[model samples]
Target: MPVPAPTLAAPGESTTPVLAAATDVTKSFGRAKALNGLSLSINAGEAVGLLGPNGAGKSTLISLLCGLRRPDAGSVEMFGRNPLDPKSRLQLGITPQATSVPQTLKLRETVDFVAAHYPEPTPTAELLVRFGLADMADKQCGALSGGQQRRLLVALALVGRPRLVVLDEPTTGLDVDARETLWQQLRDYRSQGGTLLITSHYLEEIQALASRVVVVDRGTVIADGSVDDIRSHVAISKVTLEARCRRRPSTLGRTRSARPLRAPERPPWSPRTPTRRCAGWSATASNSAASKSTPPPSRKPSWHSPAIRKPPRP
Candidate 1:
């Protein structure tokens, strides 16, 4: 399949490729295939969202790019060099799914150690506050909540002043305020000409930040292109509107129909919530009804819903 160059600067400014994977890269564990000939690329100052369902080889590819493990076949490169090269360590930053920030150490101490590796490092104070961990600087990582811990992990990744950052579900446990704050930080990083390869199940987040997306499954690149192009491939958008007036408008820009929603017994499952998916959208809406009837239309859901929906077959 044809893959478009990521949404980015004119091709001339590319000093060297930031990320490139090619050929039939495959990993087999006896009977299971983790990644198969997964060819992909990312450019500097660009954000590429690597999306796939569970066991889709996203994390495995990240590991190969970071040199955490050697690929069983094919090849992966960063900055036009092999990730196994010691030099790649200095140019890459990674925020893993689990909090890698050492819990036994004070947050400041951990950051200082990592920053010491860079000639020019981002100020620790700025990153600490931006990630909501300023007041907790002296506190040990073990004392933090899941959200705070995740924030610390982000801070560590940025302190190294990397050329390319690989983030694996970086916002997994953050509250709304914290999550938005990270997005702003990422925008700033990209604006400064940093390259980012991110894997997120949050499709909305991908839509908001990624200029290009690579959908990988069973170790293969199933689709790769701009977000608009991918959405065009599916070619339909779903529109659902819920308002405080107790009656939804008949149409919300091509909406075929609207369903009257009922209050849910609980919210949806979220790692932070300690409840089920019921605790997520459900509880939020239930609480909103008294202070405010319903959530305002979400821009992500509004545009992305129909785009991912498969069109009716003739």
Candidate 2:
């Protein structure tokens, strides 16, 4: 889908002020902590990307921001009001990782249904066309493909014309084209002074859209800065190599310095070495006599037998 270039907000339009904040928030599941003393704040018209690996608590923080869950300690506020307050969330929109709409409902009907909940919403027809769902307007949600359904899920979030939108892995299963389309829509929203909080594992996703990036790992923020600043701090490159060699490598690549192993090395195995040395001369003589009597077994010339012998169990 091709969208017209988004117009920039007027000077004052972009100054809508801080919309959400999570101060020293901590949340846990059973004995596992999901978020620990995390702090974040977002203002109107800013696009902030929450970057993290799996199980990094990005979702937990989002749940608290959307008022679906509460922090065990610290606080979360939306528009200076508790996130749990209905009025505070009126200006918020969310598209969680998984979404389910009435399977039997037509796409158009679903949009209309969601639109009815808000006092003022983007026109249903306009929303549908903007999201490239005009052709599937009458199709049942269940009949749409996964990509189409994902587009609809995100479209519904914008129906309320929310000032702040929170998308969790919004393009998780989308193709390149679908993902780009969604990105354009989000860009337009931010261009019009809307605040965005998006969490994704794809670095390209964050780099393309986020002015500021927050990297989370093991339930805490590890890096927070403008996208460029964060990139500068993490100026590392990844390289992969494949080669055939008889010996294992002590280092991955010759271009990089290698650190020696810290642990002590074990002694090498040898066929001639006995399991244990005889404690005394009598014990040694008895072992020597037994070895002489048995004689050394003859070596097999080849291991090319049709059936190989299984090793004896210890």
Candidate 3:
């Protein structure tokens, strides 16, 4: 399937203006460079997936976007204001990779405590019900399961009713059911025109929630597009072969096939060799005694061993 093209507008210019932007961002810790000239702009009402392997500077970028940490170079803006400014963060929410709620506080109390800081906040009861935490509302935070706590943490981020939300591995330790529930909640948020910037290692999580995907590798944005475009961009051809053992005549070595199983249609000009099939054979010496033998041929040669020979189709 083809991916739709992106609609772009400068910050605060169009009807749906850019809600957040990181321009030429650079950050370093000690001797390690976490981010290098990274730039990303997110518009209103969009769910963008930030994907990368470990040590890709994804977490660092998130911190800069949320104003938790300033960039070493360049600048970031939230709602057209500097991210470091309190006014810029008034409409922002974030769920960090790890969070610790007061052990003595009940779930409702914790929600209320967080809600008190915002001018307009979602009601604690309604928020708890939306996050499937109504039953545990009166339970102490320390008594909740890891999955339940994770759900509450995400719920807390939304309690302030921020226009833009950043979730860093929100479902990291969640079970399949809980993860799906959270995905549904995120989808519901998007339906109401809320923007999301999420970083996750799970490709399925990104596929389920993001309309756009940004692939980062070695602190660089390598690919950016819809799911199909990213998939097609990274797709490659693979060859499969069957190799036969020389010593163990009856025992065959079954190697795993190559990846990306999808194959394109044969070109019109290509000729088909209907009878040809792949066969592999490796030479081995059984004796430790040195034998006066010549080196193998330098050119590619055909395989002639009987062990690797297959009978012709009848």
By lDDT, the best candidate is 2
lDDT of 1 by residue, 244-277 (tens): 1114333332232342222211112112211122
Q: Under the 3 Å rule for N, CA and C atoms, how many clashes does model 3 have?
A: 0
TM-score of 1: 0.71
- Model 1 accuracy (lDDT, Cα): 0.63
lDDT of 3: 0.68
> Residue 47 CA error for candidate 1 (Å)?
0.7
Number of clashes recorded per candidate: 19, 0, 0
* TM-scores of the candidates in the order shown: 0.71, 0.72, 0.72
Once fitted onto the true fold, the runs of candidate 2 whose alpha carbons sit more than 4 angstroms away are 1-16, 236-314
Error of 3 at 250 (Å): 21
Check candidate 2 and list the clashing pairs: none
Which 10-residue window of candidate 1 scores lowest in summed lDDT? Answer: 265-274
**What residue runs in model 1 are displaced by over 4 Å at the alpha carbon?**
1-16, 20-23, 236-314
Model 2: per-residue Cα lDDT over 1-314, one tens digit each: 22222322332244558789999999999999999999888877777889765678999999999899889999999989999988888888889888676899999999999888788999999999999999999999999999999999999989999999999999887877888799989989877877788997555566667777787876788777766555544432110111211133542232122322211111122111111110111111212212222211111111111012222123
Regions of candidate 3 where Cα sits further than 4 Å from its true position:
1-15, 237-314
